[model samples]
Target chain A: MSILEILSYIGTFILLINTIIYSISFSFKKEAYSFFCVYLLIMLIITLLTTYYNSQKVNNLFLSHYYFLSQFILLSLFYKYVFENKKNKLLINTTLILIIYFLVLQYAMDTTLFQIFNLTEVVVTSLPLIIYSIIFFYQNLNAKVKFIYINIGVFMYLLCSMLLFASGNLMIELDPLINKIVWIVNASLYIVFQILIFIEWRKNYYRKIPKSS
Target chain B: MEKELLQEDSQIIVIILIAIMILLLMAVALVVFFFFSRKKIIATELEKANLAISYQKELLYSTIETQEEERKRIAQDLHDAISAKLNVVSLSTHVLIDGTLDKEEQAQTLQHILSVTTHTLESSRRLAHNLLPPILENFGLQATVEELCDEFMSSKKVFVSYDINYEDSLSKANELHIFRIIQELLNNAVRHGAAEQITLNIQEYDKKLQILFTDNGRGFDIRSIDKKKGIGLKNIESRVDILNGALSYSSELGKGTTFTINITKT
Candidate 1:
C-alpha cells in the first residue's frame, strides 16, 4: 500500500477501536453516550461495507446515501439527550422523522440517484446538526459544559466534511488530482474527529457506574 | 471556449478553499472562546470563595474578643464591688472581737459595722443581677424587658418607655442575643448620650421581629464611630451577626440616636 492509502485507512482503524471500546462502555453504564456508541458502530459497519464493495470493483458511491441518512438519524438522537430545552428536542425529533420519511420516499422513486452525489441530501441532513452544536455552544456559555470534546468535534468535522461531500461530484468530473486533494483533506479531518471521540470516552465514559452501597 | 472552462474550474477550487478556511477559523474561534471563558470563570469563583472564608474568620475572631472583654469586666466588678467591701467588713468585725472599747464606744463600732454589712449586701445583689437577670429566665423576654425598663426608670435620671408587642416565638439562644443587644444599646444611650427620654419598641409579625430603640441624648457623629473605640456597638453587631439579624442606626450631632434591629426566623 502507498503512503496515502495507509493514511486514509488510519482513520478507519481508529474508528474500529473506538467502536469496540464504546460498546464495552455502553454495556457497563447505559447513558446518553449509548446513542453515540451506536453511531460509531454504524459508521464502522458502513466503512467495512464500502471497503468490501471497493475491493470487488463495484460502485460504492451508492453507500454514501445510507451513510448520510444513518448519520443524521443517529446524531439527531445523540444530541437529543444533550439538549436541555424541550422545544429544541421536539423540533429536532419531529423534523428528523419527517426528513427521513421524505428521503426514503425520494430514493424509492429514483433508485438510480444513489450512485450520484446529492448536495440537497447532504445539506438537508447535515445542516441541522451543525445548528444543534451551535445551540449547545450558546446554551453553555460561562458554565460547566457537558460532553465538551464531542460537541467541538461534531461542530468542526461535520461542517468541513459536509462542504467537501457537497463538492464531491464536481471534483470527480474533473481530473483525479482534485479528487485526491479533497480526499486527503477529508481523511485528515476524520482522524481529528476520531481522536476527539477517543478523548471523550477516555475522559468521561470509561469509568464504571459506582454501584450504590 | 477551452480557456474559459479552465478559468471556471480554478474559480471553483478557489471558492472551496476560501469556504473551508472561513469555517475552520470560526471553529477555532469558538473553541478558544470557551477555553478562555472557563479560565476566567474559575478564577472568579476562587476569589469569591476566598472572600467568604475570610469574612467568616473575622466574625469568629470578633466573637472570641468580645468574650474576653466580658470576662475582664466581670472580674473587675467582683474585685471592686464585693471583694473590697468584704475586706472593710472583716476589719470592723475584728475590732468588735478585741473588746478594747467601753460601752458607748463599743455601740458606735457595732453601728458602723452594721451599716457597712448592709451596704455590701446591696452591692452583691446588684452585681449578681447584672450577671444574668433571674426574671429573664422565669418570665419570657416581654416581662423581662419590662422589668429592665423599670430598673432604668427607678434610676431617677433616665425615663425609659418600653412598648413590647411580642409573642415570644424565638429560641432561648436567640432571645439571649436579643436581650444583650438591647442592654448594650441602652447602656450606650445612658452613658454616652446622657439622654433622659429613651423609647424602646419591640414587635413581631409573621416570622419577623423588629426592635426600634430611640434616645433623645447628645448624639455623636455616626461617621466618627470606629471599630477600635466603640466596642459596645461592635459587641452589639456581633450578637446581631450570631442571630442572623440586621441592625441599622441613625444619629446626628445635637439631635438624637435611633437603632432599628430586624431579625428573621432562622
Candidate 2:
C-alpha cells in the first residue's frame, strides 16, 4: 500500500481505539457519551466497509452516502446532548432544520449513486458542523480544561476538513497528485481529533477517581 | 481538457486561499476575546477583595473607638460621683476627730458624717449602674429602655418619650446590645441634636423587632456627619449589626433626625 493508504488506515485505527477507551472510561447511559459512542461506532463500521470494498475492487459510494447521512444525524444529537444544560432551543432547532434540509437535498439532487466524490453534499453538511463547533467554543471559553481542549479539537477538525473537502473534487479533476496529498493531510487531522478525544476521556476518568496520597 | 483542468486548478487554489484567510481571522478574534475576558475577570475579583478589606478595617476602627469612649466615660463618672463625695466625707471625719466640741456639738458632727457617707454610697451605686445597668439584666429590653427614658426625662435632658410594644423577650446578650444601641442614639440626640421632645417607638412584627427614634432637634446634614469623626454613630451601627439588624438614618439641616433599626429575632 502507498504511504497515504497506510496513513488512512492509521487514522481509522486511532478512532476505533479512542472509542474503546472512552467506552471503558464512562458509562454508556449518559446522553453525551451514548451519542458519541454511536457516532464513533458508525465511523468505524464505514471505515471497515470502505477498506473491504477497496480490496475487493468494488464501488463504495453507497457507504459514503450512509457515512454523510449518519454523521449529520449523530453529530447533531451529540452537540445537542453536550449543550443540554445551556437550554439553547435555537441551537437545537437549527440543527434539526439543517438535518432535514440535508436529507432533502441528498434525495432530490441528480447525483450518481457510484460517484467518487460529492463536493456539494460535503460542504452543505460541514458548514453547519463548523458553525456549531464555533458556537460551542465561544460559549465554553472559560470552561474546564478538558472542555476547552474538546472545543478546540472540534473547531479545528471541522474547520480544516471543511476547507480540504470543499476543494477536494476540483483537485481530483485537476491533478490526482495534489488530491492524494490533501487526503493525507485530512487523514492526519482525523487522527489528531481522535487523540484529543482520547485525552478528554482520560481527564474525565481521572477526575472521577479519588486521588491517593 | 488541458484548459479546463488548469481553470479547475486555479479555482481550487482560490478556495483554499479564502479558507485560510477565514481561519486566520477567526483565530485573531478568539485571541482578542480571551484576552479581554481574562482581564475583566481579574479586575472584578480585585474589586471584590478590596471592598471586603475596607469593610473589615471599618469594623476594627469602630471597635477601638467604642473601647476608648467607654473608658473615658467611666473615668469621668468616677471623678464626679464617687471621688468628690468621698472627699466631703473625709473632711467631715476630720472635724469630728478635733475633740474640742461639747457632747451635743459632737453628736451633730456625727449626724453630719452619717449623711455624707450615705450620699457617697448612693453615688457609687449610681456609677456602677451606669457601667452595666442591673435593670437590663433583670427586666427585659422594654423595661430597661423605659427606665432609661424615665431617667433622661427626670434629668430634663431632652424631654424623652418612648413607647415599647415588644411581646417576647430576647436573650441576655441580645438585650444588652439593643440597650446599648438605644443609649447611644439618645446620647447623640441630646448632645449633638440639642433640641427637646425626643420620641422612641419600638415594636415587634413577624419575628422582627423595629425601633424608630426621632427627635425634634436642630438636626445637622446627614452627609456632613463623617463616619470617622462620629464614633457614637459607629458604635450604634456596630451594635445594630451584632443584632443582625439593618439601620437607616435620615436628617436634614434644622429638620430633626430619625434613626430606624430593624432586627431579626434569634
Best of the candidates, DockQ = 1
Per-prediction TM-score, please? Answer: 0.78, 0.63
**What fraction of the reference structure's interface contacts does model 2 contain?**
0.17
Judging by TM-score against the true structure, name the best candidate. Answer: 1
Model 1: CAPRI class: acceptable
Candidate 1, residue B220: CA error in Å? 5.8
TM-score of chain A of each: 0.92, 0.84
DockQ of each: 0.39, 0.19
- lDDT of candidate 2 at residue B210, scale 0 to 100: 92
Q: Candidate 2 on B232-259: residue-level lDDT in tens?
A: 8878887887888999989888889999
Q: Compared with the true structure, what per-residue lDDT tens digits does model 1 show for residues A1-213?
A: 755577669999999989988777575254458888888999999998988998899989989998999999888998888887999899899989888888888889988778899888999899999998888877776577657888899999999999999998998786565456667777888899999988888887677644569
lDDT of 2 by residue, A162-199 (tens): 77766655665666654576677678777878887778
Cα lDDT over the full model 2: 0.76
Backbone clashes per model, in order? 0, 0
